[model samples]
Target: MTDTLKIALAQLNPTMGDIAGNLALLRKARAEAAARGADLVIASEMVITGYPTEDLVLKPMFLEAAESALQALALDTADGGPGMIVGGPWRQDPTARPPLYGKVYNTAYVLDGGKVTTHRTKHDLPNYGVFDEKRVFGAGPLPGPVNFRDVRLGVMVCEDMWKPDVSECLEESGAEILIVINGSPYELDKTEERIQLAVQRVNETSLPVIYVNQVGGQDELVFDGASFILNEDNGLACQLPAFEEALEVTEWYRGPAGWTCNPAHREAPAGGMEPIYGALMLGLRDYVNKNRFPGVIIGLSGGIDSALTAAVAVDALGPQRVHTVMMPSPYTSQESLDDAAEAAQLMGIGIDSVSIEPAMQAFNTMLQPILNGAAAETNAGDTTEENIQARSRGLTLMAISNKLGYMVLSTGNKSEVSVGYATLYGDMVGGFNVLKDLYKMMVFDLARWRNQVLPKGALGPAGRAIPERIITKPPSAELKPDQKDEDSLPPYAVLDDILKCLIEGEESVDAIVARGHDRELVNRVWRMLELAEYKRRQACPGVKITRRAFGKDRRYPITNAFRGPA
Candidate 1:
């Protein structure tokens, strides 16, 4: 065996369903590694098909196209560049018995000298939390090590590294180094967990490890590609940055003990709102770009939720790609109007004024009987009028979305979404929501954070995208005169904490109340949260920054009846 070996870790962004574009990215990384004299260029899992292909794996034509792309990549290795390791769906053995026939496995191809030298399928098909691998692809066999020129390398796919048995079997089967390819998505503290998991494996097998992950947004998911290398002693050797594509060659030297990776610069992972902001940007960017939406249209109210959503939209897609509309009612405060205009100017996004008063009057004329007979109201009218105005705004936004190709961006925060504080066809109408999982308190925090610094990939001006007045002002729906959010809900500070414990921490009402909260309020918030399950179930998909988001991470049935303690 050679004393020295070089492996290129390609942490990259992949567009879902673009087989050709994905292959081009892989080839480009391959050329870069070849230029650096690396022996093998390793890419993330399902690099050719993007990730979480969902039900697309069930299509026959897509699988054929993906296989064709893989073949093309293998043939390209004929030019004598560094060999390629690419991930995609490969059909199971045709000679196998009935049920297994025509099945596809989440397979990785090892290509060199114009041929696929070897292929290994992923053993642990992850089925939980944003993964539905078991539904689409069949499980692969326990993988053994592959013989490279000098090293017997144990190759594992994304979920394979998460479990212990796979790595144990690989070590016992004569694998030298553990090289894992991943399409791991980003969560609050996942990067740290990944490192510790890798460390655990290294301690068990007495072998070095290299982890390469895919970066970029895929629908509701964002993959933070902070790949790393760890020595046999569980020491971190090399680290890559998160939320972006990176290609780095790691030098390994085999000795009497084992392979020790040469130390490289370890970038501190992004902290505080930086990582959260990055996840939002990448998630929105990929969702817009990959889905081929012309741009995004946001109903820019003077409220914090709308302001932050607009800011994220501008950061994700340039100002030119984000269009804003201000649908104002009679109750729309002058302060809100001025704040919305100021935000538009600061962010350099165009804003149009669309009055919802006419539609509101029309709705009132139609619903007069119900309002007169069955509603209690002040001089301004009742909740029926409020809902009409909201629904009118929703109609105007949807019309704009249909006229132009811009997707509507919803601005409801998790606090409001959790308690059903939003109108169904009104403020909740949007193709996607950038902050569906963020609590109201977190929204203010991120907005403040954005104003303080020009985050990377921000398309707006350097100053504040969220105006000071907007941030400082009391939040309201402005449906009725002098209406405030606090009229219906508790302060965001109290509400968000209760939500974090109940939704994320899954704590009981008594447990949350033990932290000095009103038992009555805790029970009330829990009821609202439980009752709003249907709304959340129908809400547009959003980026997840917290540990347990409202989407896949936290799945409560709309028909759920269980409630916390009184």
Candidate 2:
């Protein structure tokens, strides 16, 4: 048995379903670790097939490809370099059943000496809030420690470390160190929660821990690496940066007491709006580039939502790639026009103006006769007219998107989405909505934060990317004359609080009212939230920032009749 050891935590980003590409990433990390004099390298969960995998693991061919790539990497260990602990799907029995082949597991393999020495599967499969592992993977049995180079190492997958049972079992089984591989995604203040959980495990097991996590955007989910190490005495030994790929080698020595890591790099994970903005930028960047879009074309309305969307787009893709168009109608104010142009100028992006008044007139003329027969007279203030303006802009934006092959980026916030304040095909027309999960209040907060502080890795220019006027001005859709959002919905402060209670807190009307809101208003907000389910169902995917984001995170029935107590 060796008295000294060196371990490397490889925090990396992998593309989903790109088995060969992911294998290359692992190989590179291993080589770097080996160069740094690491005995073993630990990567995050499912690094071989990217994270989540979703139903892609259901296909036998995909599993076969993943296994082949994993074996190829295992062969690389023949060079007597650092061994690897890599995550992927493992097929237990390939010829057992006709439908599923056999039980499939989320497994971690230990590759050394040109072969896989041992493997462990995930014990707990998460089923809540953006996780559907229970449907795709089989639960692993309670596991013991894996002996690597005469040292007992207790290994746990992503969700396995959430509770204490796995750690307890490992401690009782004589595991000296706890090593966890994770694909944990980012939510608000999630970094602290992870650190606390690790501390809990350390306190319970009385053994040091090495947490390795992946970093990248996978559809709606954005994984923040922020991998860390905790000493046996519950002291933080090392911390990696959040939202970035890193490889750090840690030295360990076994004395009379047990294994203890020498002091290494420690960086406080980003706090407050920094991580939120990073998640947005990274999420948007990956979605567009990974899907192979030329760029993005946004309908810049000069409102807070649209302005923020444009800034994020430019920061994510750079000004050269992001295209902005001002789709102005008769209701579009000159102030809005100026604001949009100034904001675009600050970001060094090109903006073009297209008048939608002609299309609006054509649509009104086409529908005037039918509306007159049904409602006595067609009123300009009617929702039909308002909808036509929105549709006209949507059509114009879609036309531009088709010709230029750039995806449309929508800017509607969650408050607007929850209350059905968004037009279906109008402002809601986009391949991706960056602010879909953020409330209107959060939209304002992020915009103000961006103007004050430029995020790291932002491709846009420094200084205020969004004009101060845009941040301070009253928000409007500019669909009708002198219209404010409050004319149709409650003030954002009240609306966001109530919506958060209903959506994230899952509180009833009575419970929300207890928090100083009017019971009737709470009931009305709840009713609107329920009624807008169909619209959200059709909305494009966005970055998930909240614990209970829309889409896969929250599932509500469209045709339900159940009502909460008022």
Q: What's the TM-score of each model vs. the native?
A: 0.95, 0.98
Can you list the residue pairs that collide in candidate 2?
A: none
User: Candidate 2 on 416-501: residue-level lDDT in tens?
Assistant: 99989988998899999999999999999999999998899999988888888888877888777899988888899999999999
Number of clashes recorded per candidate? 0, 0
- In model 2, the worst 10-residue window by lDDT is 372-381
Candidate 1: stretches off by over 4 Å: 94-102, 369-379, 564-566
Give lDDT for model 2.
Answer: 0.90
Alpha carbon lDDT at 377, candidate 1:
29
